[model samples]
Each structure stands twice: as structure tokens, then as C-alpha cells.
Target: MASEELINARHAATAGLIACASAFVYLLARGYQARRTFYRLRQQGMPMPPWNFVLGHLLAVPPIMKTLPEDTQQPDAFEALCRANEKRDADSIIYLDMWPFADPMMVICSPVLAVQACQEHDLPKPPILHAFFNPLAGGANLFTMNGPEWKRSRALFNSGFSASHILEQTSHIVDEAEVYAKILRQHARKGEIFSLDDVTCWYMMDVIGAVTLDSRLHSQQQFNPLASALRRQIRWHVLDNEWNLLIRWNPARPFVQWYNSYQMNSYIAQELDKRYAEWTEDEAATSSRSIIHLALAGYMAQQKDKPRPRMLDAAFRDWATVQIRLFLFAGHDSTSSTICYCFYLLQSHPEAMAKLRAENDVVFGTDITETAKMMREQPHLLNRLPYTTAVIKESLRLFPPASAMRGGQPGIYLQDDKGNRYPTEGTNMWILHSAVQRNPKYWPSAMEFIPERWLAEPGDPLYPVKGGWRPFEHGPRNCLGQTLAMHDVKITLVLTAREFDIKHAYDEWDRLHPTSKVKSVNGERAYQMQSGGAHPADGYPCRISLRKH
Candidate 1:
């Protein structure tokens, strides 16, 4: 009886403690401490959009139902709302309290301010912004790290992704492209309507897997669960529900993520372990200059001293695995979106397609067999396809794969060039792509598909704006795989244009998904938001046929 009474008493006490903790967290999240931070920033004269108590400016976010028109007064619904809030107020910085208990974000649209944010080494990416992607980095990889660690990781990847290095990997890339070309050719023969988005994704997964990890995922041949999971993971990173405690805390959620992570990490670990063992057995036996080889050699060299570096440890293993996953997550979907959009844009504009085809024919030659042979032997000839490259630039300009974000230092507010002080303390800075790429101030006919703008000579009016275009971003933290990504894109274009002419399979797509409305650009249906990257709404339903010489 005495013991029973003691157990009851303990249970009651524990329940009380949990309740109190819950209340404390609720108060902190429901504008208790966060409200204090808000008022402090407001007191500093920060420009703020009207926000409600809990949801903040979430209500201001335009619904997906509201279509983005090509010739609309507003470029996008978000930008439209920002302009509406800025009526008579000329502040370039807009503040939005996205979460009830979180610090309001400072949305920096001014390019001048953006340049400062990009250039400042002290400014870091906010942890909250990257919480979704932390799993990919295991809390220690390049994308999540800041300061000295970031610099070290960035330097380590530089040599591997350089122009000369990516140039050497062209044969592998071409081989992958050939397999992809054969797949598409098979589809063309059947008069099948296929998803360019899907095929490009498979090809890129194969290329990045081969080049980065020296593993052939064979994504083109069959369904790779790891590739699918990585794609899904990238999409999940941008979801609003990703932060919801109820969903995140659900048992099934972590189980799925853990399973995928385990599978991917295990495969990468096996490869890493095998490579390390082989090199240890005989370093001269493994002389291939793959990215993983170079990285492992560098780590081994660093650890030759007294204290061994963490490169060969569990954390390093996870980090290496995460990077391969990151390449798939970051590289595959993004490049796929870009290539998919390129085909979509070309199909919509026959004139542009003709021009691109003409350029490819002249540079790559009209004979498919000869062209394939030449591409395999002299892959660098891809550099001569300037017009095709311009079309890609235009596609990227219209649809940037990602947006730029940076962290706001504790007390420092960003000041615009015109002496306007914008409060940024305790805030994450978002440089929205719509504001930069589609802003009329930067490019003429911002909503139109104009590849010639990129092709403009120095003294021409259509020349790209000096600081306006940043598809790959511009700074110390620019994409490490920019050259490789562009090369892959260009190679895909060269190979495809040589053999097939792609057209939009609108009829089949519409019949299957009647409820879907494709997003419009310049009064034409073109773009759609899918997962993380923008793709044609109908999964970019494409019909390919052999091009007549």
C-alpha cells in the first residue's frame, strides 16, 4: 500500500512537469518572446507588412489558385502583395512574420542590398531556414556549415568541379547522355508521350552518381528508390507542413526518412569503405581521379600528422554520404527542371527551336552517327554551341532552379544605397528570384522568352545587366557544380537536338488531368510549381520525333 501511494504521487508530479513545459513552449511560440523581438525591430523603424497574431504574413501568401499571368501588372502574387503593402512607402525591404512565435523575415529585393548580403562573410545562413535540409548534411556538411568549416569544405570541392576537371569527365557524361538518347529515341519510335522531366532526372542521377561517387545507379534503366527518395526529400524541404510538430513527430514520418537515409548511407559507406581498403592495400592500384578519390586522398593527407582528422570517422562518413545525396537532391532535380523547361520553352516557341536546331546542326553536324562519334572524342566542341547555350541561359532566367537566402546578424540592419535603413535584426533574409530575374528594372520584357538578350554583344541594348542576372548566384558561396551543371545541360541539348524534335503533348496531358491549369508566362501557358523546382504543369508531357536533315 505504501509503494502504490508513492507511485501515484510520482505520476502526478511528472504529469505536472510536462504540462508546465508545454505551457512554456506555447508561450514562447505564441508571441511571448518573439513579440518582444518583433517590437524591438519595429522600434528600429523596419518596414513591416500587416500581419495577424499567429499566422503572421502567411495569409499574405498568394494562393496557388491565383494564376501568374504573363502580362499582368504584378509579376507574381507575392510580389504583387509586396507592392500593395509598399503603397507610398519606398522601402525595398519588406518584413513578414511567417510563424507565430518566430522572428519576422526581412525580404530583401533590392539588388544593391542583395550584393552586400552576398559579399559579407560575417552573414550566415539561418539555421531555421536549413532545418529541413540538415539531414542531407548530417549537421556538418558544406551546405549547412558556416564560417571556417564552410570555407574549408568549399575549397575542397573547388578543384573537383573546375572547368578543366569537368571537361575531363565529358566522356562519362556523353555516355550517360547516349543511353538517355537511346531511351528517348525508343519513345519517339512508339509515338509515346513521355515526361522529359522524368528522363532528364534519371540521366542526371546517373551522371552525378558516376562522377561524384563512382557508382552507376542505373537510374535510366529502372526505378532507383534512392533517387526517388532524394527527389522526394528535396520536395519535402520546401513544404510548410515540414515544420509542423504533429506531422514531424508522427512515427511513420521518421521511419520513412530513416529507411531512406539508411539505404543511401549504407550504399555510400560500402563504396567509401571499399575504396579506402583498396587504397590502403595499394595506393598505386587506384589512380582514377574521381571526386571521391580526390576528397579521400586530401583527407588522408591532412590526417598524416599527430591528431587524425575526423574525415575517416562516422561523422565524416555521414558527411560524405550526405554530399552524394546532396548531389542527387541538388543536382538531379534542378538540372532536370532546367532541361525540362528548356524543352517546354522551345516547343512553345518554334522560332527559338528552329534557331537552336540550326545552331546545333552547324556546330554538331547533321549526321547523327558522326555527331555522336565527334561528341565522344572531342566533347569540348560543345563550347562552340553558343546559341544553344543562350537558350539555356534564357530558360534559367525564366525559371531559376532555386532562390538565394542568407542570415541576418543579431543587431545589424541592412541599409539600401539610397540611405534607407531596413531592420534585419533577428530576421532571415530572403532574396526571392521573382524580384530579381523578372523585375522590369533589370531586364526588358522580363516576362518574355528572349534568348537573344544573352547573345547580345557588348555595345548592344540587349546585353545582360551587369549585376542583374544571377542564375547560379554570385558570391563566395556560389554553386560549386555550376560548370558541371552547365556542361551537362549543354551536352543534353546538343545530343537531343541532333536527333529529335520535341513537341508538347498537350492533348494527351489535358485528357489525363483535366483539372490542372498550366501556369502562364507572357500570356502563354508554360510553367508550373512541382516539388521544389518549377516544371511544366502536365509533367512536361513531350512528344519527340526524329528530326529530318
Candidate 2:
């Protein structure tokens, strides 16, 4: 009996050993495959990181937190990673292996390579980004669409933002600016330090609402649904880093699609349904038209010529709401950021602010209403204020609204003016505007807030700065609203500077937190201005002394 038991135990032990050997063999095979793939990529002259069969570069990528802080949040996970990489002078291509079945992903930083990838013909937007921005109501908006669809939709929308149309919106813009100015005046009376960001956001919200929704968003009012929704969406896209993993997994595709659709579409649908019903009942009585009316007119015109393209099944009201939402998202945060940065820089450099005020005095002396009228009557006066224009330009260079992203699928090659080719396959190349603008190679004393750089003569060392100075981006996909944004920034600054002597009450001004699209200062999200957007916590803060013009 003892001998028989020992034989059975021996057999069981042998079986266990065989099982362990099989598992080891399988792991070895996986490691071999991964190594082969890595070496193959290297042989192709592609830049990549050394691979571990299990982690690839999973351990290398930074640990992104699930919940980010409200005040000092990094813009996006990718941006945070880029900043880290820049410090290390790491290779542009990173082999990211966050999950099983994950492909070798590349992160690009070179500008020329980025331009080629963005302008590529064969690449559709990566599924991850597309899933995030694809609106639920119907067809994709300009922000998501790629290739012919993106091109066509862009052209269609381009006409609406033409110079003439922007001019037509100025009256409404000025009215809102006046409201903002009054808000700042109240803060000035209290002799309190305030955030300029908050006030400017309210101003931007009002301007975008007027131009896009033909509605007034009283940003001063607490708990405005539209404003809340706008802020929520921006936070979702800009701050939610966890979405990156889900975006990577193809199995979670349905969930991603549902989330984006539900976030914007359902709310917009409800609003549109209510608006359409009211419009149907009141169309005959109304004379003064809104932006929605203009869009409807354009749609009707398109239909009259050729059967109107049913781009999306969204009702006119829903469509209008979607457009307004996008417009607000695009215009508000960016414009407000630029405005606040301008004030911050001006406050830091009083000489520039004084020069700007002097120019304001020479252009429109001692009368706020007269200045507004003059700005309206002789808009060209805007171009003539070299120092003022320089200030605006410099501010934009420091904080551009849109960060650059390259277009194309993985495996594409991008070449520079030199015969050097970059491996751009599946690369989301970034043109870090902040990094570019601050590069010491491009601007001498690049870190200083110097508006005089723009006014330099052709032969001046600063005048010959490279392509990094672009605020509106360069080439075909550049900002169509460049003229409009410029007009708004110029007028707001001129009006604000002329009426108020601004000062930074805080010991240190905030630095911009890197985000995907919009860049903002730390700890100054919402500020209390005497009379600006509403409060700096809701915007950015700046203390002001109201000047009697």
C-alpha cells in the first residue's frame, strides 16, 4: 500500500512540473513576439523605446490621477506627459503599452513633422479623439470630422464667419463689453483684488451667446444652466484623464459613443424642442432675427438651389443649440484666457500698460462712449495702435486657444524641409504653442512679457524670430475666427485699459496650466472684478482703479 501511494504522488508531481513548463513556454513566446516587433520597427529606422514583453512603456508613462484638482489641474494626460518628456529630452516616439492588444503608440513633438502629419491625406482622426467629440444629435461637427467631410463642413461654416458677418456682430459685442466694464467698476469701488479670468469668461459667454444663440447668458446669475453645461463639457474634455484608457480599448467603444452623445445631444435636444415650438407659434410676429434665423436662412437658400443636404437628423432648434454650444465652447474659454493673460502681463509691466493708456488717450480722449463710437466708425484705428496691437499679439502668442495636433493614422511618414523623415505612424504630433513661443532660440529673453518684440524693425534680432510666433496657427486649418477674436480682444483691452488702471493684488501672478485646448493660470480661475464677467473664481481676477474719462 505504501509503494502504491508513493507512485501516485510521484505521478501528480510530474504532472505539476509539466504544467509549469507549459506556462513558462507560453510567456517566452510572447516575449519573443514582442521583441521581434520592437526590433522590426527599429530596423525600419523608426524611433522607439526599448520594449519589455510585459510592460512595453506602461511603467514609463506617468501615472494619471483619476480625479484632478479644480484649481491647479494639468490640461490633459498627454500634455502632462509631454511636459515631463521635454524635461528629460526624451525621444519623440514613445512605445505606450497600457493594456493587452495595445499597439505601439507614438507621441510627436517636432513642429515640421507635426505639420506634415496634420496635413496628411490618408489619415482619419484617431478613434479616441473622434469618439470624444462626436456630437449625438446627428452628423459630426467640424471639430471631429476629417478628410473630405471636414473640408466640406469647414467651407460651409466659413462663410458665416466672414469679415462682414463679424462686423455685423460688433454692436452686440460692445453692449456686452459695456456690461462687463460696469461690473469691474463696482469692484474698483471696493478697492479689492479680483481675478480677470472670471470676468472675462462672463464677457466671452455673453458675446458668444449673442453671436451664436442670439440669447443673453447673464453670467452674473448663479446656476445658469447653459453656462453650467458649457463649463461641465469643457472640464470633461480638458481635465478627465481617465477617459484616455477607455478611448484606447475598442471594446469600450459603445460606452464612449454613448457618453459624448448623452452629454451634449440630450440637453440640446430638449432645449431645441422648446425653442422650435415657440418659433413656430411666433415666427410671423418676430422681425429682429437671431443667429439661428440666419442659419435657417442659409439652410433654406441651400435647399432652394439643391435639395438641402440632410447632414444630421437633428431638428433646426437642436442644430442651432449644437452650434451655439460649440461656439461657446470654442470662443469663451479661449478668448477669456487671452484677455486675462493680457491683463496679467499689462499689470506686471506697468510701462506697457501706461503706453497702451497713452495710445488710448491719443485715439479716443476722455470719453468711453466716444471711444466705442470711434472704434465702430473708424475700425482701422484698431490697426493704427501699434503698441496696443503689439500687446494683444504678444498675449496671444503666449496663450493660443488651440494646441496643434497632427492628422493621420499610425504608420505614416512625415518629412521636414531637410531630407530627414520622421516616423509619424499613429503619432498625435503636438505643436506646444507655449513651448514654441517661449523657446529662447526664437525670442531673446523669451520668458519676459515684452510687447515691444512685435514692433521691432525688420533687421532687429527679435524681428527675425522663426515660425514660433504664430498665435492663430499657420496654413489652411488655421483659426477662421482669427479676425473676430482679434477684434474682440483689441476692443475689450482698449476699452478696459482706457477706463481702468489695473493692478495685480496677488504677490505672484498665476502660470498657465497645460490643457488640451485652452490654457489658464493657476489659482485664479474665478476672481472678483469691480465690474467684469462676474467673479474671478468664475473667471480670472485683476484689481482695478476706475479712471474717470
Worst 10 residues of 2 by lDDT: 526-535
Query: Candidate 1, 494: how far from true, in Å?
Result: 0.4
Clash tally, candidates in order: 1, 37
- Positional deviation of residue 279's Cα in model 2 after best superposition, in angstroms: 9.6
Per-residue lDDT of 407 in model 2: 46
Evaluate residue 523 in candidate 1 and report its C-alpha lDDT on the 0 to 100 scale: 55
Please list the C-alpha lDDT of all candidates, in the order they appear: 0.71, 0.59
Best by TM-score: 1
How well is each residue in 7-64 modelled by candidate 1, as lDDT tens digits? 9999999999999999988966666556566666557656666655555666665452
* Model 1 spans > 4 angstroms off: 1-17, 20-26, 40-45, 53-55, 62-77, 87-92, 120-122, 223-225, 232-238, 241-251, 305-312, 516-524, 530-532
Worst 10 residues of 1 by lDDT: 69-78
Q: On a 0 to 100 scale, what is the lDDT of residue 324 in model 2? A: 49
Instruction: Highest lDDT: give the candidate number.
Output: 1
